[model samples]
Target: MQRALLIAAVCVAAVALWLWGFGGAEHVTVWAAEGQRAAQNAMARGLRSLRAGDPGALTALLGLCFAYGVSHAAGPGHGKILIGGYGLAARVPLTRLCTLAVASSLAQAASAVALVYTGVLLLNWSRSYMQSLADSLMAPLSYGAIGLIGVWLVLRGLRKLAARNGDDGHGHDHNCNHAHGPTAQQAGAVRSLRDAFVLVGAVALRPCTGALFLLIITWRMGLAWQGIAGAVAMGLGTASVTLVVAAASVTLREGTLARIAAGPATTRALGLVEALAGATIAALALQLLLRAL
Candidate 1:
């Protein structure tokens, strides 16, 4: 039954990949772009209604903000890349990964709020200046941080491979009983928490442009609370999409692991998969960083 389940999961994953590879991605991109344009227009209309003191205008505006976020997240973005890559490379629990995805989205929204408020109220910076800072400075910083994460993953994989090799060279029997020391376990836990922080921080360093625009406009219109609420709504909407990605990545990874024979071979395969995913992430992040610069 377990084998059957694994096979089913693998088959489903394969079909999804096939569809995504054969123009589905492009179609999704076009649809997302259209959704974004429509949402933006609706938001503008909603804002005008709010200015006119129309009933339910605030609700409409918040709904539009959420829709805008979903549409924006559906497009190609580095956040997805980072989340998906980390999910594929790490042996984390699905719930934990999904939680991280949501946290990162919320953190991103918070970053946007912090930046806009700090710039407008404290620094007395213009919208153009804030936008330029995000684009020119924050973007490259985020990409560079993501690149470092990829490198860390690669190193982790290498260490696993080296440990496996060492075991083999020492003629260690797989069936031999051994236990990890408390120090080692504690270190592993600490590393896991650190990795989670880094992943969220890297994504949060560059706030969503749409959120920034909304915050600034709302602030100017004296709807500061509304803007902050809408930004949180948008974050939840974005989390909806990232959660799906997290699920898919976990399912695919688990399915692959289930198919592999347990033992040294499985360990080796996992290491290789992690290393390859990390390498791809690093290469893409490097390219993006260069483009941002």
Candidate 2:
């Protein structure tokens, strides 16, 4: 009874934390907005210094870009949403999830680079047009992809629950044949890898506006290489925050699971957690998509 009560309390705490993070409490939202504006202003100044051929300007600009990334990521964003949700919903290894966070951040940066260069060099598209494309088309597509991920998680959880319901008391399926095939662990690893790719893709589809701005300004100033480097540095900075979120979510999830007694109850709890997390993610994605559209 005590264990159950403890588990309930932990679950409640987790949900509260999630809500506080995602729901954008007025104070937090105001602080984040202010920080972002300040960081963006500093970045613009750094770009001007670089353009003036000032010594050490490159270093300062890169530093500002990194800071901008950190400030931007501190706000409620899709990357955090996806990473935190997946961490809670799935039994992904901590190292793997952290890797995914970094990969997704870097991929997002790369997408910005690709989009800017492609538009400016090949298509002769203006900055406003490119930004509009990203905001209008890519944003919706990314949200849709995230929604699909949520649906995938929901279905996976439901299937696991169904399988558990069909399990005999011996912890093995009674209808199973002893046929040679890839082990369940191997299959799971494959699926996890695929999911990681999808997560990265979803994030990459929506390039960071800051990155796009940096790239365009640097490109106009004939510092394309520096822009690339700054974009990468910014990605690292963003990854730092997402990594923290990933770690926290995993720790919370594992801590909760540890509190549960090892039995069918634990299995059911895992399924329920996954389903609930997935449902929340899907709902959030739907809301974002609607707003974007």
Candidate 3:
């Protein structure tokens, strides 16, 4: 049973890594990317209408922005990898993980608004220049942070596994890591607010292009509030998709823990998942960085 559960968990992780690591099944890639692009196009058109100030345009714009956020998140270049990767490794509660995803997505939107606002109002830089600045400076920093976090996760997972192995005949509490549920038994091992902040920072580093474009349009059109509201809509859309990914990651880990009867084996399996997730994240970040450079 232990081996079977471990195999299942490993298979789930493998499939996710394959699909997201750049060279998954070709059809999956095309369909997902195309869908994302379509959503982006729809969002662009919606922005135009909202800017025209027709009756009910504000509500319509908000709806469209929400939809766009969902699709945009579904596409790529957000922080799906980070969210998903952390999900695989951490034994954290799925609910908390989902909440973090929401926070991170909102932070990303806020970053976009702050950047564009600073450029247009405070610095007097034009739209084109702001976009360029984000593309060049902010994008790299975001990718770099993601890559570093991935490496950190990988190292942490490896160390955990190694220390577990070194336990040898020590006969320490194997279930020490199972610190969940009520009471003082809540193991803080699986949860880390620092990690949440880092992951949020990773996504927030790069402002979304759509947010930048839409904001610039609204600002130029003298509808700054619309731009702010639209940005929030985008964040909500992104949070929805991100939460789904985070949920999946949590489910897999939980399943593995539940199915594997042996406490020690469960810990080992989790470590393996964490290690794989970290490697995938690092690889994806490097790929993005290289392309950006």
Best by lDDT: 1
lDDT of 3: 0.78
Clashing pairs in 1: none
Q: How much is the lDDT of residue 246 in candidate 1? A: 82
What total of clashing residue pairs does each candidate reach? Answer: 0, 0, 1
Could you tell me every candidate's TM-score relative to the true structure?
0.90, 0.86, 0.83
| lDDT over C-alpha atoms for residue 268 of model 3 | 64
Ranking by lDDT: 1, 2, 3
> TM-score: which candidate is best?
1
Q: Name the runs in model 2 displaced over 4 angstroms.
A: 1-15, 18-24, 168-191
Model 2, span 131-202: residue lDDT tens: 999999999999999988898888877876776665634566646785222232332253446777899999
Candidate lDDT scores, in order, read: 0.83, 0.82, 0.78
- Prediction RMSDs, each to the true structure: 3.0, 4.2, 4.4
RMSD of 1: 3.0
The worst-scoring run of ten residues by lDDT in candidate 3 lies at 179-188
Writing each residue's lDDT as its tens digit, candidate 1 over 1-293 gives 55764875687577567646677768778898999889878887888899899999999998898898898888877787788888878767778889899999999999999999999999999999999999999999999999988998898777777777666676556466673222222322323577789899999999988899889999999989988998998888888888888877767777777777666766766677688778868988998899999
